[model samples]
Target: MTRFALTVEYDGRPFMGWQRQRHGPSVQQAIEEAAFAVTGEVATVHAAGRTDAGVHGLAMRAHLDVAKPFAAFRLMEALNARLRPAPVAILACNEVADDWHARFSCVGRSYEYRIINRRAPLTFERGLAWHVARPLDAEAMHVAAQRLVGLHDFTTFRSAHCQSASPVKTLDRLAVVRDGERVLVRTAARSFLHHQVRSMVGCLAQVGLGRWSADDVTAALEARDRQRLALNAPPDGLFFVAASY
Candidate 1:
């Protein structure tokens, strides 16, 4: 069997998420089906990260094993041809050692959350970004984000349904920046609890809107209680930006 590493990109608007689901279509299902069609065998695609519904992926690394022999470029081209009409695409593919794993071998992951601070209805960016009617203080948001940039128990930011064994995680970076009307929140970590980035973005937004202060953010972190969480940003704005092996 030959193992192939695939760099995938997708628009999250149409599917249920990365994992194969019993109830709806998924990126995994699309790629797996495409792989089966190309290789004439049942194929399972494993990803570096599993995004939530409506969360996009810019470059999610995945891997699959195939029994049929084919050049890396040919395999990638065949998969893309079979994945037509679907939002998912294989940006790059290459042969790799059989022991390499998309998820287990990943060393870091990053995400970006976008917020359009405007009153007017979204025209082109509808469902692609978070629309906040109020003007946001991006600098304040950045300052507040610093509190979350280290190892800590992040219970307040984790989802109740999170399957991770621990609430503690080392947040490598978290920054908020504004470009005209756009507010961007970028974060990186080795791994994250479910909803951690969204939850952090929501609280940072509260800080941006003057609803919370930097001290409040620090207090919330110290509280480490989920109930203290102000909000969980919608998945619409979140994107799995990249994964580092």
Candidate 2:
């Protein structure tokens, strides 16, 4: 058997999430079925992280083991051919060591949240970005985001459904910046709790709107209570940008 590493990209709008689901379609299901069609083997695909419904992935890292004999390039071509019509695509593929793992070997992950700060209705960016009609002070948002950039108890930003054992995590970086009418929130960490990035972006949005002060964010973090969370941004704007080994 050979293990293959895959770099996948997908539009999250059409599927439930990265993982397979009984109720709806998923990115994993699509790719797995395509692989089965190509290799006639029941292979399990493991990803670096799982994204929620409506959350997209630009370059998700995944690995799967197959018993079929095929060159790395040929397998990638066959998988892509069979994955036709699905938004999921295998951007790159290569063989990896048997001990290499997509999830366990990952050391860092990053996500990007896009916000369209405009009153006009979205045309091309619909379902791809969050539209905030009210003007936002990106600079204020940036300053407030810095408060979440270190080790802290992040229970306030964690989802009630989060299965993580601990709410305490080290946030390596969190930055808010503006380019024209676009407000972007970029964050990185070893791993994140459920809804952690979206939750942080929501609170920072409040700061941009002048609804909350930086002290409010500090207080929320110190509270270590989920109820203290200001808001949870929708999944439309969230994108799994990359995973590092």
- Per-residue lDDT for 16-69 in model 1, tens only? 999999999999999999988999999889999999888999999999999988
lDDT of 1 at 49: 97
Estimate TM-scores for all models.
0.99, 0.99
**Model 2 lDDT per residue over 123-227, tens place:** 998889999999999999999899999999899999999999999899999999999999999999999999999999999999999999999999999999989
Q: Where does model 2 exceed 4 Å of error?
A: none
RMSD per candidate (Å) reads 0.7, 0.7
Give RMSD (Å) of candidate 2 vs. truth.
0.7
Clashes of each: 0, 0
lDDT comparing candidate 2 with the true structure: 0.95
lDDT of 1: 0.95
